[model samples]
Target: MTSLWHRRRQPDDVPTPVAVAVSDFCRRAKAAATPTEVREALALLADEDDFRVRSLTDTEPERSPLGPFAVVDILRGTAPELASQRQGCGYYEVVRELARVREEKAPPAPAPTGLTFAAPPAAPSPSSETPPEGSTARAGKSARQAAETLQSRIAPRRREPLAETEPYEAEESVSFKRALPKPRGRFTQVAAPKASYQTLLHVEGKGILESALAQNEHRFALLKSLSEQYNGAKGELGLPDLEGALQRHELMDRLTSRERQGLLAAYTEQRGAAGRVAWSLGLSPSELQRLVSMLQLQAEVEGVRERFQREALGTRHLTQRLDLLGRDKYLADLGIKKRFTEMLRKEMEDLARGELPDAVDLPGLCLAIARKHGAPQELVLRALERLGLSEGLRKQLLAHSNHSSP
Candidate 1:
């Protein structure tokens, strides 16, 4: 692996002129001394706490050491060239010896691990290096013990284990749940190429999503990911359940523009109350506004409604409907695409206008959804009362309409 030493610096460290001068002088005057010693001695004079007041009248003003250290500080600390430098040992061999000896008592390896020492650090022979004097070696330890201690500390990677782990309460109780059966089909019905015809349709209230598009894109993506988490087999309900997983589906979308407007209209005009509308009609809001904007143009209201329903319905009812139809029924209807909310609304309005027979209206189906969802007919009464149509209208609607409006 390449060392970090070669990596380019994020920012170049610029050296001060003072550092350059001190370093240059130290190098020339004390050619044999380590950078640390020269640095310290120079610093002593350069610092505010200087002990020496040396004048560089001779060939080497830095020969004494104090003058160079202050300059060295600015050099090493700031210089881009010295950014990767490690600490270098100088004349302070005493502290070095103590540090090294402290580590020697750590542990010994069974094998030499190809370790080789340059020489006995205690008995310094030659070379320019003058290792610091450590504490006196004990006279009692044999050469074997000395070798073992020395061998223990130098090897890298291998760490000395301090203690072994033992079992606490040996007998622990455990429980296990049986695996769920695999889904009868492949991982997802979505894999069926014929399952959906996902095409975008233009509608009226497109501006409803203008500001929220980017944010809702992220939320929708998360919701899509939520749709992917599967475990075991199909449950008793037979629907793919992200809700059961209970992963936080915190990304509730704000009401779409058309939903807000329609809900507001429904509240203020139809129900004679105003606050928040259905709040769930994001798709409806989009369709409503887009229809108003494009209503005069070539855009068909159903197209926009289809778009809204596709996004708004979000496959809950579609999936269940598809599942009910099974492979055979699905193939016949070209895979059972759902109708848009606007279309359904138009149908309901036609029924109310006496244009369609009761058999063709949602009275039957609404009742079914009503009973299944435990809906309140209170909303129909609420709508009629707000419209101030006949008090008879209120009572009839309350008797007939289901609670499942949203």
Candidate 2:
């Protein structure tokens, strides 16, 4: 039930600099002689707190004749401080003069039309704010009319409706389609054709994206296949899938020393003819002759070595037998003395004939003879030394005699 004036003043009750300025403006406006001066003064007042002043002057020009007296009425009712200030400046005197002049020039009052002037728009009261019962329907009709007016402005009515039939009929009814008639009511949206470059750019972008996706998928499949193959091989070999083992397996070891030597020998001797040689031993004349010569030389050298080993073994065996049995009895039993002398004579003849590979170890040969005959090693060495088997051989026998004395 609070009055609008009280309600508006309640929040802004405390005096402010704007209020003081407003009070000054109101005093000046009241003293102003002409409506022009009054309007200019009101325009200078604070817009936020004095919006009613501007509204009364600008929006409702019909109320300008009331002058600053109307403004004083509004301020007095709404704000007590500004009102008190205006009163001190003889604000009431100005209002009275204006009222007197207005009454002198006033027209006769018209009969009430069951209508009231709208209350000046401050904080609104419910009773005064409600429109009459029928006004809502009238407002809705006005709004619809206004919307239609706007729509008509945007799209003007066509001068003539489209004809039902085509303007010119073709004699043979051409295959090409005719344009369709315009639709009634709301405007239809038309699609615009895109530029060639824009269309190409979009198509190219889509193609590139699809191509990249396909390539990515192919690469993924390849990697997956390789991974499966590797894992299958590892399982077959019973190898652990340890980290970094793939790199270690890739680093293969080189051929060993014996394998390298055998490979070199095979390469040197066989060259490119190994396959032909294996298929048939039928060789060219030069190759065949060289092969026979090499075989003969190898056989002769091997035979000599074998004979030398057999002689040494036989001499040792004879020595052991002579030790077991007296030499004369052994020699008489088998005539070994004559056989031993003949063998020694043959060996000496071979050396004199230069049939041996190198100078023979005469001391070693003589020692073997001495052992076979059951004679002292020193007696054998002294006999070999007197036989003049070179100075080197003499020195060798002397060392051997001393070593074997035990």
Which candidate wins on TM-score? 1
Query: Root-mean-square deviation of each candidate, in angstroms?
Result: 36.1, 56.3
**Model 1 TM-score, all chains together:** 0.15
lDDT of 1 by residue, 209-282 (tens): 23334443222232343233322234221112322222122212332343334434443332221111223333
Question: TM-score of every model?
Answer: 0.15, 0.12
- Residue 120 lDDT, candidate 2, scale 0-100: 31
Count clashing pairs, candidate 1.
Answer: 19
Question: Model 1, stretches more than 4 Å misplaced?
Answer: 1-112, 115-137, 140-146, 159-306, 310-406
